[model samples]
Target: MEVIEVKDQDLASTLSNNSKVVIKYYADWCGSCRLFNPKYKRLAKDERFQDVTFLNINAEHNPEARSKAGVSNLPSFAIVENGEFKETIFTSKEEAVVELLNKLN
Candidate 1:
């Protein structure tokens, strides 16, 4: 699936509309966040997570989305299932993101 860019206003609706979602919170100024972009995109196409909706929200600009996802660091990932927040992970490691995706199962 494609990674969609979500804004603060549309966040709630997006969460409610999708059954499984993995959101990547990032800031343009953060080097680690930039570096993880390709990996994230790759994961979005991953067969294991094909049912999941992939989203990108700029953490520095989208306060509502950031807070809703419980973001605590520069590069954080959140999983939402059934319109509810399931888990969050703050990491630059692709393995860590995969680990979080596993929780969705």
Candidate 2:
């Protein structure tokens, strides 16, 4: 699945509507965030993640969305299941993201 770009207005509903979700919080000025875009896309299309919803929220512009993940880094990942925040990791590594995704399965 392609990553869905979410803003503050749609975050709450999106989380509630999806069963399992992985949100990638980023800032436009962060180099690491930009570099991870393609990798995030590849992971979203991963067969193991077929049942998960992938989301992208700009940390700089969406304070409410960032608060969901307690985002403190340029690239942070959070897993939300059944509209509840589960776990989050602050990382720029692809393997770390895979680790986060593992929690859903």
Candidate 3:
């Protein structure tokens, strides 16, 4: 599983470079994010999401980028494909993300 850490300055370019990008906006102090971290990492290791690039951005460190993505929640997941915003899934369930990846295929 590969996790890319994104910062504000390189975010746009990083998103543009990948045809499919799965970004998780999280903050260290958020309890929900802490709980979801392991599951999220497991999802990244799954073969189903191999083609999708996984990125983890610290929302607290990049508020501007978080606002740009409209992340009102602590643990937010966004799927961006072809530089276009696709869908967002906000939940602690790993199944939700697995289901979303299945649909993508």
Candidate 4:
């Protein structure tokens, strides 16, 4: 599975159409963001997360996008499905991602 790099303008359209979307808010300079990168990619490749659409948005590059998504923290994950924001999972752990995926499924 490929991760989609999202911009502010495309947020609404992407969330509206995608059945399951996992939007990650991250900053380049953040150590936690860097650490979580591989886990995020692995989650995207996992069979259990196959139905989900992974979107990565650089918070520093797109502050407006981050603000609109209510991302007050770095390395945050928002689970959206069918245009609804299901859950906002925040943690640096890969297991947390797995838990969120299980909850969504």
Candidate 5:
């Protein structure tokens, strides 16, 4: 349940290959993104999310992924299940993320 750093070139392929995927779209300059980093990592390592493929996509560098995920804010979280886009959590709070992951379980 490690988080993979996805680039613009690998975004599509990664999505195509993984069934349950959680992508965190972030920018280096964003303070909120920085703050959310640890939580995101913890989520990836959690046993509950073991089957989920966790990914980190740079919003500025990966426009295609950012647009596909409909990320309008820094540190946006998008979940895809069974090759379909399930939901996008637009909060920086770790609790909200935990809630969403709980729903998946």
Candidate 6:
């Protein structure tokens, strides 16, 4: 598993026809977002989530991606399964985010 940095320009294509993906919506200025960064990256490299695609989107720079994911807060997580938007969890807690990603696996 590899964590891909997503930009506004890549959002559409990234989400299109995606089988399984977990997107972390974050902004550089957010303290909580910064705190969750390391754990997010670690989870991306986790063996259990090998089949899942991990992505990171900077909300401030990628408004379209944030809006598309219905993310109203920083450090949110969105899951896309089988080309359909599944759920979005607005939380900065690494544990919560990891729990959600584990569900995908």
Task: Name the top TM-score candidate.
Answer: 2
Per-residue lDDT of 51 in model 3: 84
- The CA lDDT at 42 in model 3 is 84
lDDT (tens digit, per residue) of candidate 3 on 16-96: 988888888998899998898888888888897888888899988998678777888878888888877778767767877
**69: Cα error in model 3, Å:** 2.3
lDDT (tens digit, per residue) of candidate 4 on 1-105: 988999888888988888888888898799999898888888899898899999999988887677766788888888887877777867888888788777778
- The best candidate in terms of lDDT: 2
lDDT: worst 10-residue window of model 1: 65-74
Candidate 3 residue 3 Cα shift, in angstroms, is 1.1
- TM-score, each model? 0.96, 0.97, 0.89, 0.90, 0.92, 0.89
Candidate numbers sorted by lDDT from highest down: 2, 1, 5, 6, 4, 3
Worst 10 residues of 6 by lDDT: 11-20
Model 5 stretches astray by more than 4 angstroms: none
Which of the two candidates, 1 or 5, achieves a greater lDDT against the reference?
1
Candidate 6 per-residue C-alpha lDDT over 1-105 given as tens digits, one digit per residue, 9 for 90 to 100: 678998988877887745789999988889998998888889888888888889998888988888878999888999888767788999978778878877776
**Clash pairs, model 4 backbone:** none
lDDT, residue 24, candidate 1: 94
> What range of 10 consecutive residues in model 5 has the weakest lDDT sum?
96-105
For 10-56, candidate 5 gives per-residue lDDT tens digits of 97788889888888889999999999888899989998888889899
Instruction: Report lDDT (Cα) of residue 55, candidate 1.
Output: 96
* Candidate 4 stretches greater than 4 Å from native: none
lDDT of each: 0.92, 0.93, 0.82, 0.84, 0.86, 0.85
Per-residue accuracy of model 1 over 1-105 as CA lDDT, tens digit each: 899999999988998899999999999999999999999999999999999999999998999889887898979999999988988889999999999998887
Q: Better model by lDDT, 2 or 5?
A: 2
The candidate with the higher TM-score, 1 or 4, is 1
